[model samples]
Target: MKISTTSSVLALAAASTGSAQTTTYTNQSAPFTLQIANSANASLNGLYLFSCHAGAAIEGICVGGSTPISGASSTFYYNTTDTDVSGSDDGQGLLVWNLPVSGLPGTDHVSQSAALQPYRPGTNVVVPLFGFDAGTPVHFDDDKLTIKDYYNDANYVAGQFPDSTPAETVYNNWYSCWTGVGGGYTYEALSWVTAGVPHNPTCEKIDVIRTFL
Candidate 1:
């Protein structure tokens, strides 16, 4: 479902002078949690989006563990050139997330200067891609944030791809995945599966929840 940001929230979208007029929604002060939605599996419905570190790569994963680390939250911002007016979904814009660094001991190897972006490491191996300043433009439709593409807006999908070379699973059900340390199969990455693409049986369409706190 689409969560409408209030006029006050629109006030947060500041416009800057440039060749392309842009409106930016910065939600750092009002972080939100992205819970799995539209899933038939009851257990999977409560999973929340989180950041996971595998080797030197930081990726997005969904987990349902009971711990402070499981409380990971995120804030996002999007830039639209459609119009300078705030709160208007005039057109697709660059969507970026301020993903929290996983607090798992010894796995917090991400340097402070690294740039993170949404990426797929391999087939069905979607993770938080690093070393990029920007990602593809995305927009919200019917209250769900999605990737804005030429064909159509793509919904975010989460699932366990057991066929993947290493067989990934959601971490702790709490800790981040570390190669060769029994953490390998701990977490599965979130992927932006485009429309008309064949999805696995375990894949479920998800809705992002915008919560205050």
Candidate 2:
């Protein structure tokens, strides 16, 4: 690429106003692997990896701390273009994922809660794994499964809801059902209707997926 004085100045100015977004979970103290699943319920435009962008509607989160209960960092990127994302234009989008280099039989992961919050204004997005995708490659522990949803319908699920949640919460809640089936893990399928949320789920098992993980 050639650099010009006037072009350089404009480029720098534009670069100075973008955001990098990322979301990190409480890293397990022990070495653990996850075939994390994601649901867009929207588009991949504001998607972030390990940071946020200045104009990015959505930002990435960071994860740190020690096992069984780790912590994540806040969004951390600025002054960049959404199309500039690695995987977006080049074959480098999955920066957050290790890919081709991770644990085997990658444990399944679901996002009950978004890694972070203040999403691009919409309904709760989730990808219920009613059944594992058949005939597809087994996603690596670090492999990122894109959660692309563009038809923003709040009442998309069977229970008709606007009180959406994130994938992390979904995973955590399901994890709570580690012992058995039926009543033991019933809470994993619970959802609450806020006073003015405009939606109500009497059964609460709306986004909850019942299957052997």
Per-prediction RMSD in angstroms? 14.1, 19.7
Best by lDDT: 1
Best by TM-score: 1
For candidate 1, give the lDDT of residue 41. 55
Model 2 residue 150 CA deviation (Å) reads: 2.8
Q: Which lDDT value does model 2 have at 26?
A: 18
lDDT of each: 0.37, 0.22
For model 2, how does the per-residue alpha-carbon lDDT over 121-210 read when each residue is reduced to its tens digit? 343321121111111111112233222222344346785564455332112211111111121121221122222331322222112111
TM-score, structure 1 vs. true: 0.48
Instruction: State the RMSD for candidate 1.
Output: 14.1
State the displacement of the C-alpha of residue 99, model 2, in Å, after optimal TM-score superposition. 16
